[model samples]
Target: MPLLRNALTCSLLALVSHIATAAEAPAPVQSLRPLLTTLNERLNIGDLVALTKWDSGKPIQDSPREAQVIASARTLAGEHKLDPEDVAQLIAAQMEANKLVQYGLLAQWQAAGHAPDTPRPDLAKQIRPQLDELQNRLLRQYADVAPYRRDPNCPVWLAKARQGLTHDALHDLALTRATGELCIRAAGV
Candidate 1:
């Protein structure tokens, strides 16, 4: 009876430890808010300064339409009798640019292949979901602070791109541009 009791105690202890370990494990990082926030802030400062310099007297609603942004800023300055608000437009444009870049990359990736446009049933099934999740996070982060820059279609493009990148491809992109110079030098080209 004593031996049986000891065995039962050991089994319970083992079970408890297993459960504790499982419960205590840390979760993965899913959001890119921190990353996007930094970029958004930098873009904002640049735009606002430029806009303020072109001071047009009109309200923000009367934004100028010009081929170039600076030209638009100048036009806005002339129309509104005040400079464009650089910080405000900068934030808006940065967000827009990021979404555009993400979407373009995603479209390029999707066109490359990997089970076109289907969501994964399970997180562990493939890294594509993780990539989608990261893109979503970055987009969400951009939206939270700079809502005006939001683009719904950006995710679609991001999802496609994320799925397309294999580890080797990632490594190559990271190194290729820098290495291209070396290759040219070695070849005397």
Candidate 2:
């Protein structure tokens, strides 16, 4: 009975230690969550952009603006010590995702014959400034999580972090598109 009790106590201690170790294990996914959150915020802005376009009859595809954004991202990437091309790709993915949301929402509104009755901010004055601010925040966040981009579990972390951010399929798709460039697997892997 004494020997059996000692064995059980040892097993319990080992189990507790294992659990603690696992709990303390680094969570790269959690570390990347702030960047995901900022990205989601950027995506959500697409709804407002859609509304502005719907009201003003402005087209969704703004080539010059997209180019400017990519340029800004490239410049900011240098400041953040991130690769310029990689940052450009990331920003481009984000723009594509935003356009996806805008296109989807515009289509729905067009089919319904009217857009949602919401206050529309001026795209040039208000919206662009807001986006610029978000761009800076996003670049900073991207810098912080840049190291985790090459982690093997990056996709898993991204998917898990993205959960519950959007309920609808369109936004979900946009989120997926936005995060497309986040994880980069090494060559031959």
Residue pairs with backbone atoms closer than 3 Å in model 2 (clashes): none
Tell me the lDDT of model 2 at 173: 97
| Clashing pairs counted in every model | 18, 0
TM-score of model number 1:
0.20
lDDT of each: 0.36, 0.91
The TM-score measured for candidate 2 stands at: 0.85
Poorest lDDT segment (10 consecutive residues) of candidate 1: 177-186
TM-scores of the models, in the order given: 0.20, 0.85
- In candidate 1, position 119 carries an lDDT of 30
